[model samples]
Each structure stands twice: as structure tokens, then as C-alpha cells.
Target: MTGPGQNPNGPGAGLPPVPSIPLTDETARDVAGEQSVGGLVKDVMTQVSTLLRAEIELAKIEVGAEVKKALRGSVFFILALTIVCFSLFFLFFAIAELLADLGLYRSASFGIVWVAMLVTAGLFGFLGYRKVRRLRAPERTIETIKDTAAALRHPGEHS
Candidate 1:
């Protein structure tokens, strides 16, 4: 006979009673190794391994939190980008319409708008290219490498 979902003749019913053992630090130390110099070394190694595992777990948790923050910030950046793109599209249309109302044909007005955009793009591109070209080598790193090469070449010259 069983009560509710319980089975009287279940898999665990006929199992032998398991003995409980008291676990303590001394027991753990004794089970790991005998009291000797080798045992001391083994204990130290085990403690170091435990410490490294805890440090690695802490690093993983910190990195996970940083990734979550970056992802949250990215959502807001994406929303701002979408809104800005739509606003630019409407502004372009409005500029073209204004030009057409000033007596130009609609097609010509749109073409003028496109040409103006291309000129602006070209100006920005040229400025960006100049800035990139101006980026120089790391002076301190180059100097350090040069010093190292000189030292290697003339090792006996140093006092």
C-alpha cells in the first residue's frame, strides 16, 4: 500500500541502511596524506589549487557583470542610432522640397541635394584620411627597442 504518489515497494525500499561518518579537517588531512614533509607539501598544493579556483570563479563573475553592462549600453546606442538615421532621412527630404519650391524642378532639387551631400561626405573623408595619416609610431616603444638592440650589440661596454 502507498500513500499519494509513494510506492511501498520502491527501488530504495530494500536497500541496506547506509552508515553516517563524521567529517572534520583532521580527518580530511589524514585521508589525504600521512603526517610528513610530503604531506605538508601536498596540503600546500591543495590549498593553492583551491585558492586559484576561487580566484578564477571571481574573475568569471566580474567579466559576466561587465558584459551585461556593455550589452545594456549597446541597446541605448542602437535606439539613438535608429532615431538619428530617421531624422536625417526626413531632413534630406525637407531640403529637397524647399529647393523645389524655390522654382527648381523636383528632380533637379533632389539631384542638387545629393551633390551637396557628396561634397560634405568628401570633405569629412579627406579630413579623416589626413588624421589617420598623422598617426605616428609609438616613440617610447621604438626607443626601448633601440636601447635593447644597442645593449645586445655592446654587452661588454656597460659598467
Candidate 2:
């Protein structure tokens, strides 16, 4: 029966019949014989295995890159921190020297300098502790990889 965008009999009702490309029985058999269900399953399994292997390798590479980046960033941060600490130390020493020159050292100059140095050290130590905690915190990507690997190794284990 005719439908929308279709001829009443079939497609191309008014056109000449298209020439068919005849294939020999042997050719047809050869083409069809290679496409069994088992072969198709094997092909799919191979592809899945290949894709999984590539994904795993890529994950490993990314993890390594992330670790390297974190290390470099930490190194740079530590270096900058060291520079800042030294600068503060020098600044405090200069202040102490200025106080001594102004004859304030005989009064409470040493106490002030000592208190300032201790306070600065304590503040910086706290900040460093916080930074270290942040740096050592568990990464989401690493956690995801762990989860994925566990799932791949033992399917249906996660609840």
C-alpha cells in the first residue's frame, strides 16, 4: 500500500529498474561465512579488550602526570615559602637593628623582636600545616581510578 513519500507499488515505480551487481554463490558464501555470530562476538570482545587496555594505560599516564604536576607545584610553593620566610627574617632583623640604633634595645627591644619573630613563625607554621594538609588530601581522580579498577577486576562488588 502507498504511504507518505512512497509509490503505491514500491520505490521508484516510474523509474527504470536499476541493474543488479550479480555476486557468484561462492563469493556470497565467502562474505557471509566470515560473519557468524561467534565471530562477531569474538570481534566485539577483542575491541572491548583493546579499548579497556587503552583506557587503563591512559589512566596510568594521567595519574603519573598529575603526580608529577603536584610535586612540581609543591616544590615551587616550598621554594617561594622559603624565600618569604627569609625575607621576613631579614625584615625583623632590620627592625631590631633600627630599634637598637634608636636606643630602644635597653628597654623592651629584645622582647619585642623575640615576640614578633615567634608570632611570625607561629602564623607561618599554621599556614604551612594547612597547605600540607590540602596537598596531602585524597584526590578525586585517584579515587575514581581506584573505584574503576576495582570494578573492572571484580564486577558487581560495589554496593
Error of 2 at 104 (Å): 15
Q: Go through the candidates in order and give each one's C-alpha lDDT.
A: 0.54, 0.57
Best by TM-score: 1
Tens-digit lDDT track of model 1 for 1-159: 444665568842533323222345667766676778887789766755654454445445445555655565555445545554554664577665764655666655665666665555555555545544544444433454466467658867863
RMSD of 2: 17.0
lDDT of 2 at 158: 63
TM-score of structure candidate 1: 0.42
lDDT of model 2, residue 22: 39
Clashing pairs in 2: none
Once fitted onto the true fold, the runs of candidate 2 whose alpha carbons sit more than 4 angstroms away are 1-32, 102-159
How many residue pairs in model 2 have overlapping backbones? 0
- Judged by whole-model lDDT over C-alpha atoms, candidate 2 comes out at 0.57
Expressed as tens digits, the lDDT of each residue in 19-131 for candidate 2 is 22234465776776688899878976775576556555555555665565566556545655665566566566656565465545532564465556556656665655555
Candidate 1 accuracy as lDDT: 0.54
Cα error, residue 61 of model 1, in Å, equals: 1.1
